[model samples]
Target: MSSATTYESTSSGHMCDMDRTPIRHAEAIAARNERDEVYAKEAKARELLRITKRKAEKTKLALRIAEDKVYKYRQALFLSWTVLGVYFVFSTVFGGHGHMQLHLP
Candidate 1:
């Protein structure tokens, strides 16, 4: 005739007659906490994904700029070398260096 949970022990110090309502309540509380943990992790995962996308975009743009700069520098170096070669050839043929000359007959 009692509404409260009770536990009885035997002579060997082991539990005997015990009520199960408290056990079920404890299991339910644990399950609810586990469900809440999943929700919390979902929000954290979304934030991490967003940050990763931003970093990838920045890295992609930096790589493109670096490639463009290298191409321009390489082209300019080739042009400078070509101009120097032409100047040397003209100087030799016109007697500017006095090493060689062209005579017209």
Candidate 2:
């Protein structure tokens, strides 16, 4: 028999024919190309997700540093105010004790 008309018989007495048509080969190639395109798109999406996660982590670190600086500045301001208040009280109570002997002619 010619190659075009060749068929193989299965163990169950079924004839299996090979498809040698150009249209069938073209369809298979198109299906494979579509699968490759889908995989490429998935890879691009994963890359973008990784980049976004890195940026988010950097932003979070910067925010944490800024918050720490603000907290330290607040503590320093509170301490400065406490010291100033204590000095003011001491000066008001003792500033005139040593100047009581002033006389006017």
TM-score of candidate 1 against the unseen true structure: 0.66
The clash numbers for all candidates, in the given order, read 0, 0
- Evaluate model 1: give its lDDT: 0.84
Residue-level lDDT tens digits of model 2 in 1-105 = 764466666577665546445667898999999999999999999999999999999999999999999999999999999999987777678884355567879
For all predicted structures, in order, the TM-scores are 0.66, 0.71
Question: What are the lDDT scores of the predictions, listed in order?
Answer: 0.84, 0.84
| Best by the TM-score measure | 2
**Least accurate stretch of 10 residues (summed lDDT) in model 2?**
14-23
Residue 83 lDDT (model 1): 100
Error of 1 at 2 (Å): 6.6
